[model samples]
Target: MTYDLGVDLGTTFVAAAVARPNQAEMFTLGDRSVVTPSVVYRADDGELISGDAANRRAVSNPERVVREFKRRLGDPTPVMLAGTEYTVSDLIGAVLGDVLRKVTETEGEPPSRVVLTHPANWGPFRRGLLEEVPGMVGLTDVGLITEPEGAAAHYASSRRLTDGELVAVYDLGGGTFDATVLRSGPAGVEILGMPEGIERLGGIDFDEAILSHVNVVGGGALDALDRRDPQAAVALDRLRQDCVLAKESLSRDTETVIPVFLPGRQFEVRLTRSEFEDMIKVPIESSITALTRALASAQVTPADLSGVLLVGGSSRIPLVARMVSEALGRPTVVDTHPKYAVALGAAVVARAQRGEQALTQRRTDTAAEGGKDADSPARGKTDGSTRSRRWPVPVAAVVVLAAIVGVVLAVPHIVDSGPGSGDQTAAALAPISNTPPLASAPIPTAGSPLPAGATPGFAAVSPNGRLLYVANGDAKELNVLDTTTNTKLATVPIPAGPPQFLTFSPDGGRLYVSIFDVSGAGSEIAVLDTSTNQVLGQVPVAGQPYRPAVTADGRGLIVPVHNPESVWTIDTVSLKVTGQTPVPPDPSWVELSPDGRKAYVVNRGANLITVLDPASGKITGQVPVGAAPNAVAVNPRQPLLAVVNFNGNSVTLLDAGTDTVTTTIPVGQHPQAVAWAADGQFLYVVNDGDNTVSTIDPRTGKITATVPTAQTPTSISVLPDGTRAYVTNLTSGTLTSLNLTG
Candidate 1:
């Protein structure tokens, strides 16, 4: 009949939950939704309204409605709703009161204990106003917890955390962005450093960007509408709602259309995910920079953290996750329901605080039997009561009171507390699946294809991660697979010798395939127009071409060859061999830096990697690696490179800037190829002898997992989002797809 409750007073939306022992349930607020809009409206009769009612009435009576008051917590000015002024505190308190009333009505009684969550960077002025909210709502036993701490506590309640492990929390909500660092130990999750935030960046801003694009496409029709006209105002409001829907659709779809309605004109604007990403990349990048600063201020590195926890509805953007992973060089995780994490975590904290207080009181009552005193050093004051637990929060002002929540150690077997819970605990929750889950298209059965003698050699993914190109040696053809559908889209026949390795232009418009001659007579480089899925032509060369790479500018191609042991640079425009430089024997693979300033060739016979100048075909530096370095991979975001040694069974990491070896890691036997997860968070090496792929953490130099594959896995291509990888098997003549989801 009694339970602890937690509330997240967010900027655009509010969420609440009630906790009882091991389980917590989210309250279905206005209109049976788990979350309620933070908007408030005052009627002409001096009646205050909130949530869905306020949202529906705002368009007709815009002057009577006010929203997003949380952002003005410390402002001296008051917001006017229907000619009546109210402080930010009063607005927030009304939102909280509505949420509490809903929960109480559902349970037929008010909650026994309450806890609220707020941004970590809020100073004394803002926090003090929040401290008065519980009293305003007629709640007595209320405590406050920082938003980041609440998120971390929720993460720890599910995932196992070892003592002293650090974790970073990235919270991007509807109207604000926050970054924080936390450490887990015997006590609980503790704040590691000052939390950082960007006040004006979040999902709402992204919606505005989409709206602006719509306006531009519609010839500023939206801006031309008159706000004084009642019909125009309604149309504008409807358009904004449409824009929000389009933005959410773009997250799961490749493209969407936003319908625009004006006073006299109406139109629809088509938007693609790529275009949306470009528009918001700057602000998202800025958030990553803030996250890096948070880690630095905590005196820790990305390698020091077990993982990064993404919290809030905005963090679900696919671009956000990919950018965070690549920028941090660490694994990033998003809970099943990021929007409700703070509320559920607050509930956990509320329950733990009550449990600890009760246990401490029982001990105090039995102090005669050798129990510690009530005023022992372990006992701390929370809500003027003794709680033998401590929660450390960060603050710059001495008078800013930081309340600790989420003592996870006191929780035993906590359930998921998520929406629609049914015998599932938080531990059972899985990471967010790819926007469109990868379909299990049946691979070729025994007698499906006609290429009987084909043996797949190498595979490559396009820049957009839509198409996969696999080179077949015996069949002398390229098999194109549509990654989204997980099915073969088409096949391009090779004109000359069997294709060994495949590369794509930076723009993903052209495909370059290295044709290898089996008789050691001669070879050529075959070019394919990706748009048409047809071979354009082949450039005849003297020696055997093993693998080739296209320059960043897409104007030149770099190829490493055997027999004569030389590297060739061909002008892509003229299709002519512009320059050839002699190198050590058996130059098997070649790669160019992102800026096209340097080229690296892995010479299998020389047992080292050779650096060269692509412009003049001149040798610049030779970094010694393990024996028989067969492949090299350049990190997409960082100045790092990895080389796989076939004979030595090791991988050598190099600093691309200085051309020096940073470290060498031991891997499985007979590693054939190495690929960097687009984020550079993980390095994957395909072991031919072991028939498995070893996932190596570049930061720790430890093999995190070994995934079994088809026999003799030769090459791998990880998708741009780092969700899946395609591997080519030499013996089986088949391709293996590995799920790389974290």
Candidate 2:
């Protein structure tokens, strides 16, 4: 019998699967059915031992046994095992080899193909290691699939999903968490988005917590036990083993007894479900935050989902399953064996690759047949005749030949097509047009009649290059301007309270406005439908929402709250407060990078810009800016970051590729808002206090022009064509439109 294999090289455990003619099954190496604990022991003779053998040896030679090698997959250091130095890939290869041997033994034939699973967040370097490991085991034709994608594929295949259905895959493994949004279609599975969770967290964190609890109850002798003191080390190791068992047992029980053995004392401690939940509360919350962010990034809601599938062994914990269900308000599907699902899916993929089981072919039969016959003389003759014949040839031959040629050309065109084909074409052909019509446009000159005592704070044109939403602070309403006709479409009233900031959804269907209530009790976000110019709903926000940013998918909105040092995520569809993430104190503004992969938050209090992952709501990196970072902007065409410092009177430029501040250039005092010129050559910063706009050449990071504005210009917004810049002057109570193109 021939076999195809699937392997999941997990942090704490390794799983493998085999698929045959009519059966597909997953089994761990060395006698385990679902998973083989990823433990390796080094023998004195420079030999490596895995599986049950490694576990048995760990009791006698604890130092020689490595339990968490997967955590260091990206590390360059080699681990010494049995007097031999082995890289992470070596260990993984050994595990894979062992599994392949098992499959060969069982089927009497080596597997023809293999599929490997990896974390979605694994970057190029880590992915390289994953790709290299299989080669060490003689598996050359291996397909690498994301862990969450594998799980989602399994769910989709099992449920026989039709077109246009989305699935959110939450993978909480031993050392990492990842959530991916996928849509299953007739073509196959398409990955909509993937927001990764805390990479440093997993089941091992809970194990450590349980171990710490055991130590706390054991009168704080954990340090002694960890050092492996002859008497205490054995007791500590046994206690750790017990803690692990208890943690797993708690998955199905309300309470479990953890036994600890010491030199002269032996004790059993009863751990309750509530206590365990409390112990893991922080991690659970983090997971929920990641899930929420993923959904937000996908611009999807729980109600939009067909189902939520739980993957990874760590998700088996009752608390994890319960928290996911409670937070999403969707019934969680936890019936599948989390550890084996990925491997099983991989094996299925492997079998499909081997062409044993007939899955939907990615290529159409006509295309495949055309490809097969392309080199044949008969086909060549037909092609030559078609090219030589005129359009008025025999009706049947004309149709058939034309269809063949069209298919050949269409296949290549379809293969090269991508998400932004239409947008790119339109942008290439469109001419520059920045000015709005008289009726919808803001008056170019100052001293124009104010709109019913309205204090205009800022004006932003919608991304689609259509309407402009102007925040009228004094009038307590938003002035909607039509760009095409340059006319005011309508004025939508905003409830009076605190200063409000506005942002538009990705699709420009809705507008998000953050307002501070009168009592300072909290802030509220008002949602408006752009099509109707009507207020849809308002939800309370924590802290004072200063700069609001709608996620790229438009499902979630992020608003930076000053003073309280946090940012709140509002669910746009449900109009509910979903999650809150803490940021640096006194964050002045927040802007999403062009790719929508990261959020750059300027912290005036800390004089730094924190790079946050919007999906996971986690701070990934930070860069020191000027004295007080007041504004941040990202170039849409290039990997460049521009930051304006309120106190330093300088603009700091960053090369995003290296995450380093490349240069700094002096600008006007209190530069607040920065915008990129359409050509990406010039960056404009509004120096509010200086009443001037400083234009800097991004290539040289030098000041290019300093144009005076009305007194106390608060903000500056540029049209898509970059011909005019609308500056909001608070003191003058006027909008200044600068003719930059001229």
Scored by lDDT, the top model is: 1
Scored by lDDT, model 2 comes in at 0.65
> CA lDDT, every prediction?
0.72, 0.65
TM-score of each: 0.52, 0.52
- lDDT for 285 (candidate 1): 59
- Model 2 CA lDDT for position 155: 58
Clashes of each: 1, 12
Candidate 1: pairs in clash: 349-406
lDDT of 1 at 467: 62
Q: What is the C-alpha RMSD of each candidate to the true structure, in Å?
A: 18.1, 18.7
lDDT of 2 at 343: 80
